[model samples]
Target: MEFLLTVLASAVGGVAAGLIVARLTRGNMTGGLLGGMIGAMAAHFTLYPSGEQALPGLLVATLQGAVGGAALGLAAGFMMKKKT
Candidate 1:
């Protein structure tokens, strides 16, 4: 249950980050979305150990996920941008 919640939070964070990055960079939304998801999940797992449960922990994880998502989304958006 907690794991699922973490994933869901991470995904939501990722989507928000992806959309923001896409809009800002005028880049590929698909790439940003995928990158955000992957980065969020990676950060969540890397930062939090299993069996931890708390409101603060969840909030921190979500923030971490968002930061990770934003970073990867930005990278992906730039890489996928078409040269003008």
Candidate 2:
């Protein structure tokens, strides 16, 4: 139950962060959102703090979402770039 809620929250956060980053950076929203979702999930599992691991406080979660969204957006940008 907790895990499911965490995932759902993270996914929603990821999507929101991704869309914001995409719009700000003029990148593809769909790609950024997908990448953000992956990164958010990865971060949640790998980098979450010890002990109180119940969805990470609002600030932490937002930070996580932003970091994940930014990282994914950057990756998407590089991948979408045309080789010259």
Candidate 3:
């Protein structure tokens, strides 16, 4: 249950960050979305703080996920952009 909740929170954070980055950068939304999900999931599993309470843990997970997502989304968007 807790793991599932953490995954869900991370995913939501990823999606939001992806959309925001895509909108802000005018980059590929699909790339942003995929990058965001990958980054968020990676961060959630690897970097999530240990031995924390429920709400705070989830919040921390979400924030880290968002930061990871935004970073990867930006990179992916930049790479996928068509040169014009």
Candidate 4:
């Protein structure tokens, strides 16, 4: 189903965002994960279109989610309060 595919795509996007954030932030696992979740949630709400076919929609959602998630994660990284 398109819904499931959308979730999967969002998860993949989250994981990718997490990894990238972790690497960029010198291995902040918790920050990366939380950022990824926020990013995924953002993509889920923002990108998924209704009544789409399975494969193409999945592909589109994945790409959109990936980009959106990364951008959001990056922004969050900058915006989040630093713990000193």
Candidate 5:
């Protein structure tokens, strides 16, 4: 249950952050969400320290997740050969 909550929280936070970042970066929200989810999963597995839950707060986790998501999104965007 805790793990589920962590993933859910991270995913939601990441999606929201991704949306905001994408808008600011002149990118697409849909793709951003997907990338954000992936990033959130990665963060959940690798970034969170032992005994820490997802992150201290939504904003911090979201921001970090957003950074990762944006990176992935940008890479995807470049690979797709689409103009933003």
Candidate 6:
């Protein structure tokens, strides 16, 4: 169940990134978290849709997932800000 574990870890990473980014940016926590979750899942599958178990691929995928999650989280945060 390495694949399952990998996805789970990625999901957890996404949640953590979402919460941290939301808190740091003072954004909508719920929106940012949801965006991060979706972005991470997309990154994970987009990188490894074939389910390859290569170490390098996994590393790259995970890194990209985190980046994607962060990007989405940041976007969500910014969108939540008032137009002051």
Better of 1 and 4 by TM-score: 1
Evaluate residue 62 in candidate 1 and report its C-alpha lDDT on the 0 to 100 scale.
73
Candidate 1, residues 1-84, lDDT tens digits: the string is: 767787778777876887688778887888788888888887777766554553235666677778888889888877887888
- Local accuracy by lDDT, each model: 0.77, 0.67, 0.79, 0.65, 0.62, 0.73
Q: What is the lDDT of residue 29 in candidate 6?
A: 88
Task: Summarize candidate 4's per-residue lDDT along 1-84 as a digit string, tens digits.
Answer: 667777787768776876587668665555566677677767677544443543346667666666666666666665564667
Show the lowest summed lDDT stretch of 10 residues, model 3.
48-57
- Residues 35-82 of candidate 2: C-alpha lDDT, one tens digit per residue: 778777777777654525545765676577667766776577446645
In order of lDDT, best first, we have: 3, 1, 6, 2, 4, 5
* Candidates 2 and 6 compared by TM-score, better number: 6
**Going through the candidates in order, what is the number of backbone clashes in each?**
0, 0, 0, 0, 0, 0
- Superior by lDDT: candidate 1 or candidate 2: 1
TM values, all candidates: 0.81, 0.69, 0.83, 0.64, 0.61, 0.77
Q: What is the lDDT of residue 25 in candidate 2?
A: 74
Cα lDDT of model 3 by residue, 1-84, tens digit: 787787888878987797689769999888899888988887776765452343336787688789889988888877888889
* lDDT (C-alpha) at residue 28 in model 4: 56
lDDT of 2: 0.67
Tell me, what's the RMSD of every candidate? 2.2, 3.2, 2.8, 3.1, 3.7, 2.7
Return whichever of 4 and 6 wins on lDDT.
6
Q: Which candidate comes out best when scored by lDDT? A: 3
Segments of candidate 5 deviating more than 4 angstroms? 48-81
Residue 78, candidate 3: alpha-carbon lDDT: 78
Number of clashing pairs, model 3? Answer: 0
Pitting candidate 2 against candidate 6, the one with the higher lDDT is 6
Tens-place lDDT digits, model 5, residues 1-84: 655555577677667665566667666667666776776667766777664444446565555666666666554433444565
